[model samples]
Target: MNRKTLALSAVIGLLAPVLAGCGGSDGGSGGEAIVVGTTDQYIATDEAIAPLDPAAAYDTGSWNVLRQTIQTLMHVPRGGGKPIPDAASKCAFTDRANESYRCTLREGLKFAGGDPITADDVKYSFERVLKINDPSGVAGLLTNIDTMESDGAREIVFHLKTPDATFPYKLSTPPAGIVSKKDYEPTKLRKGFDVSGSGPYTFKAEVKGDTVTKATFTKNADYTGELNVQNNKVELQPFTDADEMGKALDSGDIDVMTRAMTPEQVESMVEKPKEGIQLTEMPGLEIRYLGFDTDAPTVKEKAVRQAMAYTIDRGDLVTKVYGSVAEPLYSLIPSSIATHTNSFFNKYGDRNLTKAADLLQTAGIATPVKLSLNYTTDHYGEATAKEFETLKDQLNSSKLFEVSIKGTEWKSFRPNQIKGDYSVYGMGWFPDFPDPDSYIAPFLDKDNFLNTPYNNAKLRGELIPQSRREADRSAATNTFSQIQDIVADDVPVLPLWQGKQYVASRDDIAGVEWAVNSSAELLLWELRRGPGAS
Candidate 1:
């Protein structure tokens, strides 16, 4: 098992108290039933749920609910690890080249509504997601699929356009969660929040008082999967801001809180321990960086890019702006993962103002290179303003560069960025999956997720494809290491920092520590009241 997998296994082991029925008994005589409180900022937005139908649900809030309420062929084990069989009895690549894959469904599988789950449903699920092809949906991840066919009553086969070792991992995500053909429309998305899924929980979403502030889930007794639900019910509360969520947590209105906490709030919680509150600091795979528009006149020069990379002090940015909630990232791949390489640090070393100035001078560039730095205020956090200001101060201090910082809300910023409206801009990524490919492939590929055009033929055409062919993920480390080195030299983007995952919960919650799943989604099934609770 990898470091992430091991960490998840450890978390699962810590749930012994919850699994042993310590808090499952009646409140009067034995103990109180566990109640989990979670916050979703995405749902709090105006366009609530983008689309609740699995075919169109791509946002984080919708995914969080879908992952629990729906069943996929494979799933990440509790406490964050490798993908194992869930709906399928066993799944593996049929071909030696890793192109063809197959999955055999487990016997006697049924949805929460008691509808039988069969290979036909599995085939329909993948086809429906592809046919709809919602731009916001994650169907792009399934582009490698050439065809999906049901082999028999229990077996399903996938024919891929390319050899993608990560395909199985993708199936464990919400995009691949199987939906009944009988319940869903084949061409269009099913409207409303009602769902018929076969996962551990039965989910019901509603917009209370004309706004989607809350979604509740009940444990499905008919669930035929690996996970054992510890709580009878889980409630997801959407807050407009972190302050509201923090207040709710403090007042015991919520048993647990995850995501949307500002860096300062996290630091405060860490500095002063709250009475009966516990925090779990897990390794995060999220990365924030500055992407450069290659076509932009200001940053078109390679030397200018290298100069910016060498001049900025990442160490200072982490300490002063982030309050040490994040660590300076040397590579696009986060340091927590095995494939990460300190390529930038190796090439540029610590902050060297003179070296940066000399590089620009040698390239015949004039002094005080003017560049506009664009960032999104609403998306990243209020601290993002401070982060960019610190960057401006750091670069301006060198006297070799003049910086102009601008901010916009995420909704406006994304489209403008994609249209190549910004010279140098800030962007953060949350991985779709845990694999190293999630970091490198999305950024470096020809049709990258970034608004800026960054196509490295070597990294995109060869290294990534080669790495995907390797069945053992560790063996692909060499390919990723080389890709990082190329990124350092090219300087298409300057990695700022990689964050650490933190979850705050009441100390009475024993299983709260293991709430996060392998995909980094918080699993309410793992949370239950600990010993000596009210």
Candidate 2:
């Protein structure tokens, strides 16, 4: 099946409406402005959004905003799947071993503030992200880079420590977004809401009560990129609650709702068909999993981790907690990606109590092992409580374990998880870039974002490094296969389920289906208020 076919199959029989380009009651060819609603208040809440400076903005909300305002050397094209030149006229590996990369800037390139974009700007942008080196920042993605050199005003070259074919893909992310040295401080982070960028949109933000309540994005006439703005003006609004956002969508307060809408919300909208609202489902690379801190007394034993993985019923978790909105995942890499392998499923076919028991016996573990599982309530969704409860019930049913469940908000949860306060915890990953390496490297690296005590030399030293050198993604499948087998054996983390992306908008919105871009950032430029839209 083709990509579109595969994406449609995950929508649970709502494929026809999405594929037919169905619009809401108030439908038109699209010319009016739009208000996009999101339950993702990370930017508004100030709890997750770090410094908005391109170098320090690592969270999803900050990146979503930056991706629109700042132009990167290359970007995942709108609706198209591959990375393509955005700020650069062209970009490619210059060396035979893929250690060097070069890009030539588009002529007459200028920032929104009218500063000339040059090779110097490109070099400064990358070096600054590395220089700031915020612990939470995404500079780690550029660790392979040895140095950057400017050929002239228009061309820049990158030298690498080792052969890395995925370097260009890393540059396409927000951390590599080119910034004007004339506007931003080279060493210190740029503060305040004022942003200087060169992309499809010029952002003007409004901060109210420590949250970005509204962001007004105007078209950048100076932008020299692939994005063609359909709507002249777009306003992004944040809601503290999904129900509030849902009401706004139904009341025509917002033209579209993009992120953090729970499965229950989507199902409610689909079943009742809210008068003017329609749902568009896209293929998502979001994977939810359980991480085991190998240093934790309860899970230090590999058998305990394997038993937890073998005992939980993924089918029931998806059906009961996720309501079929998500599919059970068996690999760290989402199945949609080319390098994915169902190693976990192959190793442990189903929830076999006998097998879990045998594994525990082999490791000399006593029965009724005490386990503490931690999760965040506000971060994931309201359903997360039920999800953990269901998981606790499953493990307790095995009669070999006693589980304690703890819940906290994301603000406290993140720092505590990083401090290794949780014995076992749940994590949901939205990829930094669409690659198998993004899944493997960040999660297993010695100083992983999760801060779990997980270490596999073969995976960290050999398989991942070997896979990074393969220019052809398909040829690296063997390396990814080995990585997955190792992940299954180590049992540091258990793959749970992968979610399907859902965007709900009023029927009059014409481009709702295309709102989610290849990098999984919601493109507000794609949305337009249709002819009869409220």
**Candidate 2 residue runs with Cα over 4 Å from true position:** 1-32, 43-51, 191-194, 531-534
Steric clash pairs (candidate 1): 8-79, 80-518
Q: Estimate each model's TM-score.
A: 0.86, 0.91
Tens-digit lDDT track of model 1 for 20-95: 1122322211134344444444322333334567776654556778888888888777545677898898999999
Q: Scored by CA lDDT, what does every candidate get?
A: 0.75, 0.78
lDDT of 2 by residue, 1-534 (tens): 002211212222222233222334543223445788876554423433444777766656677788788899987655444578889989998878999999999998999867789999889988988887755537778767898899989999999988987787788888888888877777877765667789889988888755577888888988987677787888888787788988887677887887778888878766766556677777777889999889988899999988887899999999998885799999998887776889999988769899999999988999989988999877666778899999999999999899989998776677678778898999888788767788887788754667667888888888888988877777788888999999998888999998877777777776776677433587777767655332
Q: Using lDDT as the measure, which candidate wins? A: 2
Instruction: For each candidate in turn, give its C-alpha RMSD to the true structure in angstroms.
Output: 4.5, 3.7
Give the lDDT of residue 206 in candidate 2: 86
Error of 1 at 244 (Å): 2.1
Cand. 1 TM to true fold: 0.86
Worst 10 residues of 2 by lDDT: 1-10
